[model samples]
Target chain A: MNPVGRIGLIVTVTAVAIHFTGVAYAQADFEGIWNPQHPPRMGQPDPASVRLTPEGQAEYESYGPDKDPTLRCLMPGIPLGLVDPYPLEIVQQDHQILLLYEHFHQVRRIFMDGREAPDHWLPSIGGYSTGHWEGETLVVRTTLMSPDNYTWTNGFPYSGDEDAYVIERYRRDGDELTFTGEVHDPRYYEEPYVVNGRWNFAPDGEIWEYECIPEFGGIQ
Target chain B: MLFIGFSATAHHNGATYFDISTELEHSDATVVSYDLVNPHGRLVYVFMDDEGNEVEWRAELPSANNARRRGLGGDLFRPGDRLTALTGSPSRSGANFMRLTRVLFANGDVAQITGRNAGVVRAGTE
Candidate 1:
């Protein structure tokens, strides 16, 4: 082969590699502002139908909207914030995924770089997330959530299991994103509870501050 | 027609405090102020009762961000602006707590302020 032809072949191969590399990184794009196509209800079986354990039943009976921490301008926590009515923005990077929720101005981080969650960690509102891509789907395992957080605004509380784990699956299509979560709480729930929601890609939407100040007190 | 005649409500424990199945009769009111806050917003206004006594009513709304998306702001209703409001039933029988659904200003302007749940006819449009 001529020397000039050999150089041309090398250049062509390099260009192809670069093009495919870009596509590989782009295959798992979850970056965008999104809102549910239809507003989502809390979780499966309705609160009226949920079979709570004795302790959970008592907590359910005693709790009311007045006792809701959100009334005090506190974070709604984990699954609640995940499906908040306001728009949510997802920013993806090589090693991390950042979620900015317009509600409560909550920011959540999901580690993407092969880092495992600590065996023992403090509880938090958004909890600790470690995510990996399964084909086009993003699967996240979150734990260490604050026990004080209620699963729903309607007074249904989580079982507060220190080992309570939440598994969430996120998938994105052309203009739609779907999220499904499973709460494994052996302490207070008769069985694993499921929560699912759908969000559409909102290119024109922007996240806004939902500052919950303490001064407002009518419903609290 | 894909999106018409459908009402969307924001995320809140509405069923916890308000009767989702009941709606109050439309009332004639004069606006006092608009409280755009988190968790929910409140519309403060007064109306004349059947006994001709002044009654102050507080109507709950969606969060400020939802309201902003719906084109509602603190300046939408002035203190003396006369409006007809369609409200939802209150949890308490006599309490003035109600969910503001639609509002019609006397000046030929009709605005539907239903949060999360919209698509109802404007109060005077029907």
Candidate 2:
């Protein structure tokens, strides 16, 4: 190769290597068993603060406790799973981060390899999560969530379509971890629904198995 | 030690089945059976009413894993075990159902099953 070409190639490789090294050093250590400081509220938004669309209001009014997905042993999904009262273990890796929850043994994978969601990806309870580090905070964006029939703590209904998305920021400080999330569903709400929660590091905490059995007899 | 507080409406809506605003106490209750299962634990017992009728009731306790963390074992209560006082919230629909909060054994031991007073199981004097 020519001298100029070799110089340009060496400079490009060095810049890419420095960028990756910076990301590695800037990554915060969130690896630990975290116990929620407060009981899980199932990502319930205050009805007074939430401005729902006409369709959303109708769905909310029609919600009943019997329609809860958890009663049928289905995963609560996304923000609900994230804020569950059970302990969760965060396993950080180069390509992805794994969130192992004790609530029904749900596992969430947050890809950090800069891959975009596929066009024809199937919607699911946990959805698809892509995470990137911004300073010391881990920012996660999830999309393509299935609109399962479930009611929030205050009877607010989840009626979003596949376009519904959630953005979360996880910040770790010492032994405390704070989380803030915003749910965006233009079809359901006029504004993004916001929620906040916190967790404390449990050095001796361990995730226990959660076995759920649906009570068909009790379902009416 | 991390103490996970038990919410009455944790898994499902407690208000739909339970009259959470009121508390009921059943004295001298006899255990019919105890099932340590998921979603919630079931404690079936029979108690004599004011009319001298033996009425069977079902009390929903915390999940088995939560009970274990609170020092309660699967074999804690067996059939025919006598309880001095079994306290909980009664069903809103007037069914034979309850949301268990505490259990006082005949031997003077106390087990605070749920709510703010949970996680305390005192030794019996006997």
Candidate 3:
């Protein structure tokens, strides 16, 4: 083909790729404004799993509320953000999932859609989350976390171990998409810990940045 | 994950009280039929079924000062019992994870491992 013709073809191909990428992001829940349709807050609360035994209670009590992670601006990490009742925008890519949260505007990247979990994984604040489709759910299993960064808002909380698995089941019915998760901490809980909540889709919802500022003296 | 059946009760602001401790421990909870929203200041929350969905509660974090010594004793469950809970704390949506501050059990029993008693154990030599 002539130089002019070849140039036009390349441009056309690039445009097609870009258009497809935009379409893909537009179709995902992670990329739009999402509000918690059913969160486990105390009043008419929706909680995660509950299996904190007496022993588990003892251990957890030692780590009581004053040291709550949210009191600080620490990252809520991977699957934790999914249930944290914050609006998050997902910047989806062919190989990675960028989880953006409204809580702190914290963003987590998961290499889903066929990328290998990193070897020599670093102990992360949120760790790492990888996902794929299992029928209607996008099953995600996370690993490589340091138990020091998370908080337990229910019967039992994640202790940041290899055995601690966070599973996310996401599905959409009509305009709203629902994502539920189960956190299993074998050492803490006596059974398969499960928690449930839902989301309301806001196609027009916009993501605002989260800026956490520490109290200068006694002010939060 | 399973959605355990919720205990039916009424609370303030048209909120219904439900115990998820049993659900988390024993029964598989179905979708929690409640309003989910952006957590204003929650330490942790869970994604029951939505990708960006979250819920808050009471929990014990690692910073409770003297937790390592106050270890878990007498297994609370036998691997198949259900435990559900409810929390007042909301999730901090911008963090790496969510937290539930004060955890309660299925039978209206709140978890308390706060080491009302304290002791220590020596490491055994191999």
Specify the highest-TM-score model's number: 2
Off by over 4 Å in 1: A1-27, A39-45, B1-11, B92-94, B115-126
True contacts kept of each: 0.37, 0.19, 0.00
**Alpha carbon deviation, residue A113, candidate 1 (Å):** 2.2
Q: Which segments of model 2 are wrong by more than 4 Å?
A: A1-11, A17-26, A39-49, A149-154, A216-220, B1-17, B92-94, B123-126
Return whichever of 2 and 3 wins on DockQ: 2
**Tens-place lDDT digits, model 3, residues A68-185:** 4554555656434546544556666766767676766677776664554578777776777777766555666767766765434322355676787777677777667676667667
lDDT of 1 by residue, A29-114 (tens): 88989975543463334666666788887887887767777778888777555566778899998677888877788888888766
Candidate 2 lDDT, tens digit per residue, A119-207?
87888888899899999999999887777733254455555476678899999999998888888777768887787778899999999
TM-score of chain A of 3: 0.74
Sort all candidates by DockQ, best to worst: 1, 2, 3
> If ranked by lDDT, best first, what sequence of candidates would result?
2, 1, 3
Name the lDDT value of residue A207 in candidate 1: 81
Point out the worst 10-residue segment of candidate 2 chain B by lDDT: B1-10
Ranking by TM-score: 2, 1, 3
Model 2 residue A128 distance off true place after TM-score fit, in angstroms: 0.7
